[model samples]
Target: MIYFSLQTPSIPTLEETQAVVQEVHQDLQQLKPNAILETIRSWTPGLLSFSYRLLYAAIIIIIGNRIAFYLRRFLKRTFDRMGMDLGLSKFLISLANAIAYAIVIFMALEKIGIPSTSIIALLGSATLAIGLSLQESLGNFAGGILILVMRPFGIHDYIVSEGVEGKVLNIGLVYTTLLTVDNRRITIPNGTLSNAVITNVTAQEKRRIDLTIGISYSSDLKKAKAILERIYREDPQILQDEPITVYVDQLADSSVILGSRGWAATEDYWAARWRIIEKTKLEFDDAGIEIPYNQMDVNIFQKTIDK
Candidate 1:
């Protein structure tokens, strides 16, 4: 390898450093006189300008909020016009307003130069978590929606479901409230109700009232049937289109069971049933129709003693 000569650059002298510093100071002084802050102050308007800008921004926000409210109101009105359930319509309106407010807030955030993208991501994550946690509630809500849409029963309709019989008082998002004939309040979960068998007693305009009358085995069957038929004929509430049925259904140990069925308006079902029972008792008493009772006999055998 051939040897080469190396040289180092010489450092600046003290006097040369002082000259550089002086030049930098002079430049800063020259730039400071024409700074942007002083120029902005010279061009600034009075307080009225600031107030106007603030008022304009406020008006924009107010308009946006009011628009959201009106839109929600319109949606609610439309649902009401369609004869939808009050609970469902109110829930939907609240949901719509919430969504509209969220959108308005996002737009306002953008106006203020806040990063809304991250907020949207956070909201999406939160919504997903909440939905997962409320899965069963959502399912029940859907079931309620189906109930209202399908209209299996209406208010004050007598319905039997989940081994309970009652009148439907109101239908809600998660459950259906009922008033039983015994003056009891029952709440059935929509999820269970939707899946179970539902018997709507008041779906039809008329229903059949079934009554069984038991008489003494020795009584005349023809006479008992005739008495029942006469009572049904006298009751004006009893429907004529569907004729009353009366026949000997079964022979019990103590009496002959007579089955009687008659049609009546659904609204008058209970009254009709009571009337039939009362009339049956009165007629049977007048005709000396003995309604038999169950009787049991016991025989005892004693051992004979011979002395």
Candidate 2:
């Protein structure tokens, strides 16, 4: 019979494991510096190229912005030379400036590795989204275009619309600015202004001034009429070619109303009206004419009750 011996494999000792760990740690320490250097060496060219592109884009933006500003100034001068309508000129200038800036942005983007066609596609999508979200703004833009085409009013034209009366300061892409009589600035949407009933106050070269002056019944009606006619004739601002009439407008309870009508240069309407009214008061005073005031006379009688 053959005898077989079973032998178990010997496991590694703790010292042996510790030695292997030390060898691996030393090898990693020796490779660390070279690995870092290799990484930097590999990335340097790409980093430099990206940095150059970034700097070039920045330069493009700066130079392009300056060019856009100068272009706008040139356009403004050209429009002024052409005697273009102030509102239309301003609007066109704004549009051109916007286009120039857009071109600059696209060029800068291309330098930064973004394609212009891609940008245009992105803008198309964005515009569609914005158009749906901003319908009112789009309406205002359309209205502005209509205003430019229709020529109903212009910059510096005094207009009254929707209870707002003022001199138009600007007609912009979406808003129309007005400077009020009291020097308040008002901004109204172009859409609203376009749809509203606008009264062009200064459109005509001449305007008629109608004044109603009331005198007491005791005062001479013919004398009051004569005074009004004389005031209209004497005023240099009033137009002599236009018909000037003073008539008995109404007979009220305590006074007779005299209606006076005169025509004057549109620009001089207020001055003529004020001057004539002042002269009428002075003339009536000298002629002993009385302007009636609203007065109430109350009479009370005492009644005694006896029980």
Candidate 3:
């Protein structure tokens, strides 16, 4: 037979237990301030580095903006000296300014710890998305470039396209502004404008004025032609170097149509035409020439009572 021996564990008194707890609490209280100081010391360098970076970023932005402004001013002066087309010069200046600002922004971002490569990748993605979504706008931008290169029309040119007639106010990247004769502003997409039939009224140095005058068949054709030729010769705006032609154009049922053609300076075209028409009317009346009009004669007979 085997036997085992055991002993009961000793239990501490209540006063002893309370004294131990008090001792531990006092030890923790003594270490708390040291722990707090250690934590602050560990974070100090990182915090200071972040603060310096933020301040540097701010300075970069400020300096970069100033440089961009000066650069834009310089470009404007250079373009003025070169006598560049207004539309093309404006477009190029704006494009340069945008590029400068983009560079400045990327520099600021890099100072704040953002990588330029990452930014470029993000921009690439964004540009692809935008290009897909704004295809028409991109087309308009391309059209603007074409307009600047080909030079179909220029600033202040009076043009008629897509049924809209106006003076070109500005040609931007995506839209071309027009100021109508009535002082209304119209904005047209450059893409549409580039594709349409553009009639530049003031493109030439001189324009022709063609007028058709109708007189009674009984009127003397020779006299009408002679009067028209004389009027063309007397008009100061009509260019004497150009050929003037007046002839009988058509013979209708009740009237003979006389056609007159004369050349005038582009700027004087409207005034010259108006003056010629007014003088022709006055002179024709004075010469006893009858301008025919349609007239219907009504006859009522005894047949109406029979009906």
Candidate 4:
């Protein structure tokens, strides 16, 4: 009997449902203005801080530039007195200045509320990727440092390496510049130069000049040697302390080649060799010694007619 008129609870009408949704929306709208005001109030301090940070960054940049410039100039004068190459000096000073500026910039960013530690950690994590991407550049950088330390060759020194021969014009951060005798400029990577076989032709004060003279088999070997020795002796450019050696070195089908080695000042090596060559020829002509050439003897006669 109690359940006889139990009605199924009626679902709300569409109108009622819509009215509830409208009420909820109005409440949200009323809260939005205050939320917006609170948001702006919170951002005010941040905006003011941002402005100060910008000003500080500008100051840091200006001061950093001046400090970098001053350090570079000071290092330049010091390096010049130490006989450092101009190229090397510039690289070192610029590197120091760059590091100084980088620190200042990072500090300014920190002052602006950026987390410097987090930035550094992120950079450290990415280092391997960066290095892998720039492997050649990193290698060249290391090679430059090695070159500076080893001092294998300096500017204006004539050197041959990696199949290239020239006078070093400049040693840059990544490459070395060379000027060939024909006036061709070559840029060689420092990484390659650091590992290549280097021949410094003018590193020493004295160098040996080698000259070869060929004479006929009938010519007196002893007489030719004597003339060469005398010629080398008379040349003032030849180093007197070092012994000059002249001997029959090779016998070709046509003539006997005399190998002579004489020591001379590095600057005078070519001149001494040329002078000795000319003098040797004159002495041979005067002494009636024949400088032989290749000639073939033929006996062709009646056999050709018979054919």
Candidate 5:
């Protein structure tokens, strides 16, 4: 007689495997109540641990945010009290706020057991990319800051930069706005303006008017100079300390150049310049001085037909 074994095989046949799985599933379903209790007994402590950590991280973040906010406000107030430029103060405050928040974020992550070194590295890479992409913007920002600190020009100050001559209307973070004499509004990038030669016409309390007049070489230089000097002296608006200079500047191909220079208040610069030009022209006409122009004598070199 053969004896049948009661123990199950470790690797069952296909049908046996399916049947055993179905039976085990049914048994597990029957034990669900006890199984859930056992699972809860095991997971209660871990869940509580996770919850406490999350709560701690949240509290840290809240405190950090508050601290950062207060610090930014304090810095802004201090700068304002010190009479710093409003635009610059606001920019500094924004930058400080961003930095403070970034530090707080990193600290919060670190408190939660996240390795901050990787996060910092990742942020550094991102910052580098952003910086490279915004190089021109960064340059403009730097230029604006330099202008604000150095005070190369001020509002309503006349200046010539990057081929634009106008009165400064506003200095922004990325550009400077100007109102041209012809009433045109122009915007110039601060980076380009900072790099080029800046002629600040209103930096000084007094500015000199530069007037040039061309006269025929045959005209009497002494007479022209005397006439120019008299016009300057007769003008009550001209400053007394600043001498009116009238001298021959150069001998061009067609004419003699007379340079007239006189100092006046910066505000009166344009008025003085216009007045000098008008008066000089009138005086020259009255004195019968010839204002010469460029003349050209062209001789055609032609081949003559052989006779």
Candidate 6:
């Protein structure tokens, strides 16, 4: 059998390294600027090609911008024809223009020779990051969109939601503003309002007024009901088409509670309600009907034995 020896190369000492560096420095004197000139010469042919691409991209961007404007106008007209809210229509138009411009920008970028796939990836990542950070705001924004589109309630409509009762003043992107009966303004997040139990009082043409009154047990139930019904009939604002309902709803410890329901035009609901409340007391007084109150009798036993 023959044995083969494998020898390792020895490392260069300091002197050998210095000598190599000196030799490289001497060779640098003979080198020219040919490498830079060659690079510029090689790129000269592509310059015209790149310039043309840039010019084409510019033209595309300009034409796309004009198209975006035209689309905005067309969308506005379409939305108006479809009976969309005016403010919402404007917002949608602006959004459409933004999307159009973004698409044009990406196309232009691709024409300029940048890879569109990489740009889209970068945009997607950025959008994901922004979306995570703005989840709550985005939810409110989405809720606003739903409200605008569905129109659950409109401006000046009286609504009750989340234990707050008020007239809607403005419906904005992130929040809804209301004016309370006392004329104080309050704003609620659209997200919360969208999920809440919304009671729109004036959504219908006619409104119902409910009033409750109490009288002594001795008073005639039939007469009391008749008086309430008459009051509802007398009110001009109260809609006569719908039937008025009055009944002895409950016999409480203090009095017989009569519940009255009357229908009125939406605009006259408050007037009818106030009139009924005021006239009930006057009618009962004239009829000598007593409105009962809580009373307790304390009988003191004679303390003669103790005395």
In candidate 4, residue 57 scores what lDDT?
Answer: 83
TM-score winner between 1 and 2, please give it.
Answer: 1
Give Cα-based local distance difference scores for all models.
0.87, 0.92, 0.91, 0.88, 0.87, 0.90
Whichever of 3 and 6 has more lDDT, that candidate is 3
lDDT of 1 at 227: 98
For this target, which candidate reaches the highest TM-score against the unseen true structure? 6
RMSD of each: 9.6, 10.3, 7.9, 9.7, 9.2, 11.9
Candidate 4 lDDT (Cα, 0 to 1): 0.88
Runs of candidate 6 with Cα error greater than 4 angstroms are: 1-45, 250-254
Per-residue CA lDDT of model 4 for 167-216, tens digit only, reads: 99988778989999899999998999999999998888999988888999
Q: How would you encode candidate 3's per-residue C-alpha lDDT over 1-307 as one tens digit per residue?
A: 9999898888999999999999999999989988999999999999999999999999998999999899989989998998777767888889898999899889988999999889899999999999999998999999988887678888888899978999999988689999998999999999999999999988999999999989998888889889889999999999999999998899888899999999999989989999999999998998888899999999977654554
Q: 90-112, model 5: which lDDT tens digit per residue?
A: 88889898888888788777777
Estimate the overall C-alpha local distance difference test score of candidate 5: 0.87
**In model 2, where do residues sit more than 4 Å from their true spots?**
1-127, 305-307
Per-candidate TM vs. native? 0.67, 0.61, 0.64, 0.64, 0.67, 0.78
Which tens-of-lDDT digit does each residue in 1-307 have in candidate 1? 9999999999999999999999999999988887866777776775556666556556767888999888988998798789987877788788888888887777766655567898999989998999999999988888898898778888888999868999999998889999998999999888888888999999999989899989998788899999999898889899988878998999988889999999999999989999999999999989989998767789999998999
Model 3's C-alpha root-mean-square deviation from the true structure amounts to 7.9
Cα lDDT of model 6 by residue, 68-141, tens digit: 98898899889978998887898888888889998999999999999889989999999999999999999999
lDDT, candidate 4, residue 58?
85
Model 6: worst 10 consecutive residues (lDDT sum): 27-36
